[model samples]
Target chain A: MSEADQGAVVDLLGVLAYAELTAFDRLAEDARMAPTLTGRAALARMAAAEITHHVRLTERLVELGADPSAAMAPFTSALDTFHESTRPSTWLEGLVKAYVGDGLAADFYREIAEFLPDPDRALVLEVLDDTGHADFAVREVRAAIAADRRLAGRLALWGRRLVGEAITRSQAVIAEHDRLADLIVTGTGDLAGIGRLIERITDAHTERMKALGLRP
Target chain B: MSEADQGAVVDLLGVLAYAELTAFDRLAEDARMAPTLTGRAALARMAAAEITHHVRLTERLVELGADPSAAMAPFTSALDTFHESTRPSTWLEGLVKAYVGDGLAADFYREIAEFLPDPDRALVLEVLDDTGHADFAVREVRAAIAADRRLAGRLALWGRRLVGEAITRSQAVIAEHDRLADLIVTGTGDLAGIGRLIERITDAHTERMKALGLRP
Candidate 1:
């Protein structure tokens, strides 16, 4: 691998490791917003799952001779911005973010993971598995929207905002981390390949939104 | 089993299930107060452990044909008040609360567990295992105190406040919920047994505080 390619691998793993840790943190905090104890514990379960995923990624980073903390430090601001800008105010909103926002992220990562070679691709593929979490969020959000039809409009707007903010943060990442971007293009062997990857991400995100009864 | 004994068992499990869930929530929230990413992950690991214990208790409640949610509802206010009244302002304070507050709770619960018959006693004993988490908190708090002697005075006061708040809530629980409290007494076979139980709890709390360099 080229030096730039190596940098990109580090960047990807670092971003992913921090992302899982932060997801665990935010989901735990979001559980407090749940109206029912049952709902609260459900969210906490999902949060706990994130920790296991985080452990797997950290192990991978360590095996690669990287300090997990230092590897994770670079993309902290971008992910933090995404979460801060899109903090969910209601339980439904929280579920939508979990289902929609994270679904989009996983879709994007899966697309990128395809470009990785050998075991890295398999490892990334393995960790990106969603563990059927979206089903719970989908059922919860869809039921809430059904009970209060007006929630449909507000939540639909919330879903759009979530996507918008996700895109905004993602674009910042692409702009600022040219090495990582170059790695994607070079890994795919063409610029058009990156274009198709973006298109695939957008398509999958639309499906996730529809699953949550929100318009993408 | 007497009908009243059965009710008490339900009450105990319900209260404990909720406590475990809330501990997971509050600990996850407290993790945000951690100064470093490494420290934050440590707390998150601790938070995840609470979920496993919570799941076990909930399973037992289900096996008894009780609705876990309804069972846990009664103790919600007490635990919430304890947490709200004792929200830790700093990382060290949070560590102290996690170590001292939870250590005391486990000690008390273990005493109560001994009063339970057979399976329940074994179940509670299984759940109360701390797995050396207190050592981490004690080390962190003591190192912080050593770094700043003035912090010792402030944290000592925090430790006292923690115990005070914990006791006040425990008193409220005993006053408000006769079923569970009666279980402790009748199960112990006398008031002296309960009195000795309290003394044992007090002794353990003092040891926990001393471990952290605080006077109980």
Candidate 2:
């Protein structure tokens, strides 16, 4: 691969590895907030799936001769801040975050994964694949909203906040990792490519919010 | 399987399922206490392994037509209390708990695993396998103890408390779950078998404590 492509790949994997790590942390903690043991265990299984992805991404990093920890270091703060600022106060909020916020993030990564070379592209796609175990989240959140219509308004606001925080963190990650930015801008052929990338991410986020019965 | 064997199997699977679920909960929470991102990930990965075991046991329970949550419910309080009472206060305490506390519990499960027939016995043995990702814990704790001899005094006490809490809960479980107790007594060919089982578990605990640079 070209040097810039290699750099982009490393940066991408690094950001993703850290995302999985933080996802595990936030979900595991959130599992504790679940109202039922069944709910808690389901959330925990989702948390486990994130670490499973982290293990794979880190393996690829190591294969590329990067220190997994060092590669993941740069993106840790941005991801942590995203989660910290958006900490879910209730089990419902936690489920909404899992479905809406993480769904958007995964869509963005899937977009980037398309711009990569053979094995790396495939690896990125595989790792980013649905952890969409968010089925439980959807069922629970939908039921909560049905039982109390007021929950819909609050959760809709939470969805907006999650998207807002995610965008801010994405920008921070882009500013801090120019190589990653170049991958999106140049890999897709120009500034318009970057525009289209952002647009696609936003569209997907809207669809997810709709799926969760929340207004975007 | 015999009716008694069936009851014994359900009780055993129930206890193990809850054990794995709580292990995941406690380890994930304790991962926060890790001093380094690397250490945190290690603990989180260990926590993830527990959930994997839980998923399998719960699957087996469902195959046998048992409700996973219902099967796990009986031991929830005992397991939760063990964790609640032994919540680690610092990074080192977390590591010690992961090692000594989990190690002893795994030993006990492995002993129980021996008497059951095929698939269930195989499943138990497999689930109880070396979450021995404790190499990290061993190295870290040994180094910390070497650096501060007085720390050993406190940690030794912590280890003892963990064992004490575990024993009290084990007795509570046995008292409450006669089917599980009968499995030990009859499955092992009577009371002497139980004696040998206890002896084996005690011996293993002492060895693990010594390996951690502590007294049994």
Which candidate has the highest lDDT of all? 2
Which candidate has the highest TM-score of all? 2
After superposing candidate 1, which stretches have Cα over 4 Å from the reference? A1-6
True contacts kept of 2: 0.67
The TM-score of chain B in candidate 2 is 0.97
**Pairs in clash, predicted candidate 2:** none
Residue range B12-121, candidate 1, lDDT tens digits: 88888998998998889999988888788888888888988898998998998899999999999999989999999999999998998899898878877777777988
Residue-level error in angstroms, candidate 1, position B11: 1.0
**For model 1, what TM-score does chain A reach?**
0.95
In candidate 1 the C-alpha lDDT for residue B3 amounts to: 83
lDDT of 2 by residue, B54-138 (tens): 9999999999899988888888988888888999998888988999898898888888778788899999998888866989999
- Separately for all candidates shown, the number of backbone clashes (residues 3 or more apart, or on different chains) is 0, 0
